[model samples]
Target chain A: MKTINKFKMQLCAKSTNESFARASVGAFIAQLDPTIEEISDIKTAVSEAVTNCIVHAYKEQNGDIYITVKIFENNKVKIIIRDKGCGIVDIKKAMEPLYTTGGSERAGLGFAVMESFTDKLRVISKVGKGTTVTLFKEIKSK
Target chain B: MECKLNMTDDTLTAELDGEIDHHTAKNVREQIDLEIDTQTPKTLILDFSDITFMDSSGIGLIMGRYKKIKSIGGKVKIKNPSPNTYRVLKLAGMDRLAKIEREE
Candidate 1:
């Protein structure tokens, strides 16, 4: 559990920033020398989390998203994406695959994609407060 | 994202480049839809040869297109997705609806 490196960034919860947030996390985690597949997994999971903030949490309002990446010993990387916006009332329903409150265009597979790509997934939220999604992965050396 | 369209008598082939995420998915969907609506082709082939990364947004894009094309009696074929992108598509069960082909 020794900390190796860490970085944090705060961004606008605009949909355009979704790519930026995921790419920034990918670049930061690149220092750990993750494989190509590992990089893709991390980026996809990060994308899903940030998209949830932009599409569901803020829901047409401006907000801020916080992203933190921590690299620890044993090549484990943990990422936390948080937003101060409308929170989910039913975590179980929200986590269900193809269960999205967004419009028809939304596939509702965000949480499923995040869970599949990472080793650990944790979500905490309050209806009037905010939501936080934390994802952890252990990079296997090539 | 850049989309290149190639059209023949009954097919519209679109070559997409760059990353496919929520940020770019809207524009991508619109552009492809415009072509499909105008051409009314029998088949729509999406070329993913240059897509470096894709997420659930990409899945939504594909699914949306599949529905639109199916409504007009057109089939959607996905071409040359990278292993990572293919994995995302498979996870979303896109393979069942659309044909995925890896170019040799």
Candidate 2:
């Protein structure tokens, strides 16, 4: 795949940074001329991944979130969100909707939403080290 | 994020404005819960007309509120969610918990 454009950012793993991550990614993805719905899907996917870093990865403590966005041939966009925090015990179980470990304010639909909104979703984890989520989507805009 | 709340006919309507994300949800939850606890209304309406962005965190917000309102014998109504937001709500099966109205 030929890379057209790419950028990387490192942000604090905090709830406040979630919107910043979404907006920054949304802006970068805009160059592909994605439809409103397409952009929303990407933004939502980014938010979910970043929020996971804050809530589950760092546990609201303090860490760094790394995001890399890539634009490839055929208007395909790829995003990687990573954190060096507590990884999931069971990827399959954590991906289940409403099976949250983040307590009352979480619905455990992060991975599900990413799967539904994007063309491909991938998760990699090591229990004591970190987790990385990659999201891919092709923009077919009007 | 900002929420405008009103109570009429025992219905407490919260007009949620701005993006609903993990960063802002905590404050929004506190505001709505405070009103729900005080008024104890028969209905809790969440107006999303002004919400510009939402993620799964929005689902968590709604689900938590639904449980809170349901325990008090009240119901929840989600109003004017953008099509994108509605898709998320439907994906999570939230329509079964709250009555969602489109563009009213």
Model 2 chain A weakest 10-residue run by lDDT: A96-105
lDDT per prediction?
A: 0.93, 0.93
Supply DockQ values for each candidate.
Answer: 0.83, 0.91
Q: List the residue pairs that clash in candidate 1.
A: none
Off by over 4 Å in 2: none
Residues B1-104 of candidate 2 have per-residue lDDT tens digits of: 99998999899999999999988998989999999999999999999999999999999999999999999999999999999999999999998889999974
The C-alpha TM-scores of every prediction are: 0.98, 0.98
Judging by DockQ against the true structure, name the best candidate: 2
- Chain A of candidate 2 gets a TM-score of 0.97
- Model 1 regions more than 4 Å off: none
The positional error of residue B66 in candidate 1, measured at the CA in angstroms, is 0.6
